[model samples]
Target: MVFRRKRKYREKIIKRSIWQQLPEESQNFFIETANILRFAGQFFVELVTPPYEHKEMIRQTYEIGYRTLALVSITGFILGLVLTLQSRPIMIAFGAESMLPSMVSISVIREVGPVITALICAGKIGSSIGAELGSMRVTEQIDAMDVSGTRPINYVVATRVIATTLMVPILVFYADALALLGSYVALNLNSEMTISLFLNKVLGSLGFMDVIPATIKTVFFGFAIGLIGTYKGYYSGRGTQGVGKAANTAVVTSSLIIFIIDLLAVQVSNLLMY
Candidate 1:
């Protein structure tokens, strides 16, 4: 059959390491990039316009922020405890046990707190929004909303985005506090570090420069996660399979974007620090 022949020919060309398909892939990437850019532009435009979804946004904030506190707290504590415990041997070898508090505090505030919080949010929240919206699209619920004169973008996308933007920074604050508590707990194991001394050292080591830049970057991270989740879910392919794909791809892609944003944020922070 002609179909079999065409398939065979295509495989033959590919096995020959032909450059014929490279342009197609490049073109597809550009096309996808353009579409995403347009989607983001629409999002911003709708974000500023009137008829805000205040109630929905608030509800989402509670769901996204309050409901996830336990997971974030536990993860943060373990992270801090492990980080301190792992770094302990190095500090002890160098006879820098007294400096452990300051070092751990700086590392948490300047980097670990925001990064870990964002990664967790990306996995928990990003896939959630993506699957929710993807299911709506698959079941034609979004279309029904359109017919009812409801602003799906405003009601769904905007609320989720704004909620994420607000909640992630708050989560980071919790993570930082819990991480410090964990650090204290870890310090007490096989050592006699006092709570007062730990607090004093941590406080002394921190400043506006550490907190402010880290907080600002977290806002951007939250925005990226929400945007990708919303975008992937809103424009997902056809059927329940598409819903699964959307959620899967959203988490993976958003996590990658988080790292990308974090790298850029660190570079910018460094440039500004000098």
Candidate 2:
């Protein structure tokens, strides 16, 4: 009996040791990701069959889209300017300075503009949604809404999700435009080129294939960011501290999803382009 008890104790120690070796944070992340997928499905369901919140959605769209314009514009302009300036040395080295406009346009349209714009949105909007919802959840405001016959999920989550879905593309377009303008400015700083000449090269290089694929992927980026934010916020725990955690987690997770989606999109686009 004594030997058996010692064996059992050793087994228990082995089990505890093994469990400790496992990555708890990774396990929790998988669980959270699964929960977000479920929450995303629920959001779609609520969106399609709704006591539609038109007023709230419009409000959210304005908040997400209009309020974001200045920031997006500035970022895009700087991005284009910097990209142009950076690429200049390389192009000059290659004796391909003439290709600058097309090259910059292609890079901005196909990758940089959409990705950067989406990332910015994720950082700003994702954190806000998470903190707002997390606060409501922790303070029992969500509970109050439920008690009062208001579907908080539909009213809050759905509207924001839809707003994000619609707004991100617009932001991307604005970013692309501003980035191109910046590129043009950068080019003209070193050389005298007509606006018409620069635009012709830019317009010539961009095809349906590049523009369409880039735009399509941003929609997924927006959805992922919105869904993760809502999921983190709606289900946040640990009270006030959880709100901060949710915000931080929302930004991190949403950014990760954006990169993953962008990778898949690039693969798809390559296959289609080829």
Candidate 3:
């Protein structure tokens, strides 16, 4: 009995040591996720307070939203074309090529379009925000704002977060439209479906549930991107290298969180639909 108890204690100690020695990669991930959550909370607090920066937010919105139009549009068009082309052979094999328009559009609007747009934003806007803020932190500009009795979070974080939240949905809307157009072009490559009938079929397959949930998830994606970027940049260390690291981590983490949240959203959407 004593030997068995000793063996159990040894196992416990080994387990504790293993836990303590978690890989550096895992530790960094946890720290980054925690920081994102903390920053998001602070962002919310600032969002509700007075002294709203309407002008700055508008400037940020244009910077983020309008500037990103080209990227999103191009990506949307490619996505739709590729998706349709790839799925066509498989659809034809089943003798169901006629279902292409509705299937392609539904897939795009419901999942691919928004997620792809968000990922594009994650790589572009997310990195820019992180690098910008990280540079500011290194230069002590944020500290200067603090010293001058201005709330840096209220000004910087609030504006970017709100800007992303407002803009991503609009981007998604445009992306959905562009993607559908591309898919329609692809469909015309082999078949002769009329534009009106194709649209009717696509819209018939999609209800408010598909559009609303997908759009809602984009907001969270925006939030995650904003929070991760700001957190990494705000707490950046070292010098130029630190800013690069902050931007790198912001894009990587935000992209990962977007996918994870997307999985959860799909599961929840399935439940709701049933």
Give the runs in model 2 whose Cα sits over 4 Å from its true position: 1-22
Look at candidate 2 and tell me the lDDT of residue 22.
72
> Tens-digit lDDT track for model 1 on 76-132?
999889889999999999999888888998999888988998989999999999999
Q: Which candidate would rank higher by TM-score, 1 or 2?
A: 2
RMSD, every candidate, angstroms = 7.1, 5.0, 4.0
Q: Flag clash pairs in model 2.
A: none
Q: lDDT by residue for model 3 over 1-274, one digit each (tens)? A: 9999999999999988986799989887777667667777888899999899999999999999877999999999989988999999999999998888889988998899989999999999889999999999999999999999899999998999888888888898899999998998888887787899889989888889888899889888888787777877888886999999989988998899899989999999999989
lDDT, model 3, position 272 = 94
Q: Which ten residues in a row have the lowest lDDT in candidate 2?
A: 26-35
lDDT, residue 101, candidate 3: 83
lDDT winner among the candidates?
2
lDDT of each: 0.90, 0.92, 0.89
Clash counts for the predictions, in order: 0, 0, 0
lDDT of 2 at 1: 100
